[model samples]
Target chain A: MTNIKDIAKMAGVSVTTVSRVINNQPYVSAEKKEAVKRAIEECNYRQNINAVHLNKGKTFLIGVAIPFSNHPYFGLLVEGIANAAVNNNYKLVLFQTNYEESREIEALMMLKHKQIDALIICSRICGWDIIDEYVSYGPIVLCEDARGRRVSSTFIDHYKSFSIALEYLHNKGHHKIGYCIGRKTGTNSKQRELAYRDFCMKLNQPLKPNYIFYDCFNFEDGERVVKRLISMSNPPSALLISSDQVAAGISTCCKEHNILIPNKLALMGFDNQPIAKIMNITTLEIPLVEVGRNLFLQAIENNDSSHQEISVKLIERLTV
Target chain B: MTNIKDIAKMAGVSVTTVSRVINNQPYVSAEKKEAVKRAIEECNYRQNINAVHLNKGKTFLIGVAIPFSNHPYFGLLVEGIANAAVNNNYKLVLFQTNYEESREIEALMMLKHKQIDALIICSRICGWDIIDEYVSYGPIVLCEDARGRRVSSTFIDHYKSFSIALEYLHNKGHHKIGYCIGRKTGTNSKQRELAYRDFCMKLNQPLKPNYIFYDCFNFEDGERVVKRLISMSNPPSALLISSDQVAAGISTCCKEHNILIPNKLALMGFDNQPIAKIMNITTLEIPLVEVGRNLFLQAIENNDSSHQEISVKLIERLTV
Candidate 1:
């Protein structure tokens, strides 16, 4: 309800004089300063922090565009971002798009409107076209995939990791392997699918349509996919899962059916999440916390700059 | 940066006349309106939205005080709150206190300064003195414990759930049972701990000092606790864990050590999260999503009212 102009007008001075006094930018006469103070006291004026922060065009608020914060995968990633943000004297503002196209656009709009300094998209399944449209607004980094764009991204090498798991199973004389992959639209999932297809084609193996199950990158989907495999007349001897949570679900299903792991069936998982470590589910461990930290740092530095891509690693365990 | 006073002063008119022009509140002459408009344009001013928001003492920003957002326990809670806040046209401003006393005070300061409309404390490990001090600033709602305060709260009956768990174990002939709880400083954990003490005392069972472990609430802590239990000459027949993640860790450790569940050593967990369902973890389920939603709705209403508290339930499963 109060502003610099109000104080200035009341003090019989220009708005610039009030601005200088408020910002402590100097070059103000003592008499004018006293008059401005009197006017400010009388009007009960308060400075708008958001407006001032906007003028600098840097809010020190990093927006983390996560699909869902409740899931284990993103949960770790968010912790990484938040931990990094606080250390850097920045705060995190979560923008859960739920993979909705409109919400992604809204995240971009926030940058254009100077609401947030940068954005980190973790496990987004949206198309590249939608992202490309808003790439110019601010810094946009991908957590799971490189996207092949100039954008700075932090991701594990999904193709290589998938190949490594396949090779491990292949070396164990398992020609028939069922695969459970998360939503196929994203670059990461696509890479995994491609790896699976390419490996089978190269080895002259027949790919079973029923063996592959599309999942939502969660434990329930892992259970659902495992059930599909169990119900089939001929299930694959080995399975490669999208995540550790999925592997847990599959392991639970196996226990229910009395199918002992590595004895009756072999399994491998990805993301090497903490659960993976606990369950001893064979998986390719990616530096999730590091990815998150690097993502935030990238966002801060490249707030108004271009994009870049980061890579991932593989960790082996006993499941296979 | 302009206010009603500025326009009135420049137009040589009363503040009431400027307010009438700006808000179209009626009874403003054509000359006065023209003068006000000209003065406003010359000043290049914008209304202080924060000040206007504060004028009504409503920021439309709800504060969610949570311990950790990176874990499934609080992550799900935050998700439910965010979803409800979005649907209701309100923004949930995360105030992650991490159970720290200083950050808790920061949240109270925000409420006192009218930066947040109300506060929804997910769990109170902070104690009653701090809570009482902030209660008068805005409406406060507790998530999992009443704290015996007059605040509105929504949570499950920890005592009932613990009793159910212990009774199930008792019925299963488990004379030697170990209880693993979170940090005892929190109200929720305190309830769980009290339940353990009372039930053990009523059953005429002496509590083993080494059988109880206090964790900081994470997967690593769960794993560490299990390691300690496994090292004992006469370990407990069953273990009750504070969270599903912790249970997963203990289960993983058991698998590695060739220990069996509900067979060689029974295990039960709390919070029946997504992983718990997949793992068939026998425990009492706390409806965290419902807690989050109800607490947020209470916060919205709290914007104009006082404190209130709610109730909780126990969803039983097969862990015992």
Candidate 2:
């Protein structure tokens, strides 16, 4: 093996000069650079690319911080990001936080250490203040509608999408309409809550506390919600679910219980996932793939700090 | 501000000596090692950990190469790998190849370049010759049953499991049995086809070429298979689906076409994924999470080029 020592000795320069030349550091004379290059060529040394990348202050690697990897929504986003990374000649290092603070911090630390050129945060438990601290390190692109936080972001207007779902349900002669949520405190959920409340107030429909199901993320959660809803003294006529997966669950459980959809209980889901089309569940189509592509673009540009909004549209299916 | 150059100058030693000291390389004289240490301490130098890792020939990073990121089987496997990585203080660098040879080469290159300590190839398109060439670079762990190639592997006994599935379907009085495949030439699929053929030949049952569906990896593909199957002059009374998601699609499509599961068509799916449970499809449990953990364990061990076969169990559900 031709070590750095060999290169230095062969170049007939101080080890410091050889080190500087090898690392692509400035202040090395043209003569020393030529000598180092000649030595490397003569020795045919296979240098670790990480050494070059560390010196360049960029790795062409993007860090994607997401709470989950297997979830269809996040999976679609990751797939889109993967395509962009391939096209742009970058690699994505995933930080599957699972909503844990410690795991999320690992990604931010990688940014601080210059392990990655940029970061794309899909969702976060940490506050904006915590995220802002790493802004100077490199581009920090958010995959959320955080236009108010002053960073590059690509997201769908959850409030508007939720409003579309609620208003559609309300106009369908459903006075008592309830909804499902993943988390009460998440920005998307908060906006959805606001939209639900505003729609109820505008339509003069009384809001039922029990109708709001919390933490409904998957199909099983939707089934559990439906089981709970049926036992209630008075259940809503229609339900606006947080995600299509949840709606799929409710649909399956409903079939088992012989609860005819739309005829007995109207259901509307969000995200318009492929399953939604298969299940014929009317949904708000959140362009997550577009959000992912835009996030990568912003991170690569590392500038503009402009908020990018991906449009959401309502798809009509038999469930509503 | 204190780079390797300053450390070399301060230590009164070659930059290579300072690098060897920082990288914890052996064979340095006591005097030089002590001098480099004292100089580093005096300067309060904070070396780039990446530089140190590069020199040490270790990065504590494992490259995970999978065809899809969001698919349930791969997602579960990745989640398992992520947990193992976190526990072992290693990071997973994902290469979502999507069945592309070019993308898969990137991970192998990273392994050769010492960017990653090892590679955990979940699935790959590259031939064994290409994969075997990189054996000296680092430990290569496969998610498939490729024991014949002389590498560490964590995989299911697909042949045995498929035989079990076929025999079980036979005992259930299904003579006209068909199956779907992701790729015609995949090891798992080949085993499954062998089982299907061996079972048919032994039982003196006729094999219908039209029943063998190709490229049935996803939900849409499965739905396409079902649509094509029902239109055939003679369709199989039962189907052994390639994956649970595909089975879910068939189940959903069956519901639309006013077909009764188990009675009209017996469906058996693989992977026993969460969607399988929701759809109530009978499946062979591959224990993907267990496979992932075992792969990581073998990768970290970096020895014992033994073939590991994870057992598969048949789970009875309403669909079958």
Error of 2 at B250 (Å): 3.2
Identify the candidate with maximal DockQ: 2
lDDT of 1 at A91: 55
Per-candidate TM vs. native?
Answer: 0.74, 0.81
DockQ of each: 0.16, 0.23
Clash pairs, candidate 2, are none
Misplaced by over 4 Å in model 2 are A1-48, A51-55, A148-150, A203-209, B1-57, B204-208, B254-264, B302-306
lDDT of 2 by residue, A196-263 (tens): 88987887777677889998887778778878977988888899988899999999888889988998
Q: What is the C-alpha lDDT of each candidate?
A: 0.72, 0.81
lDDT, candidate 2, at B37:
96
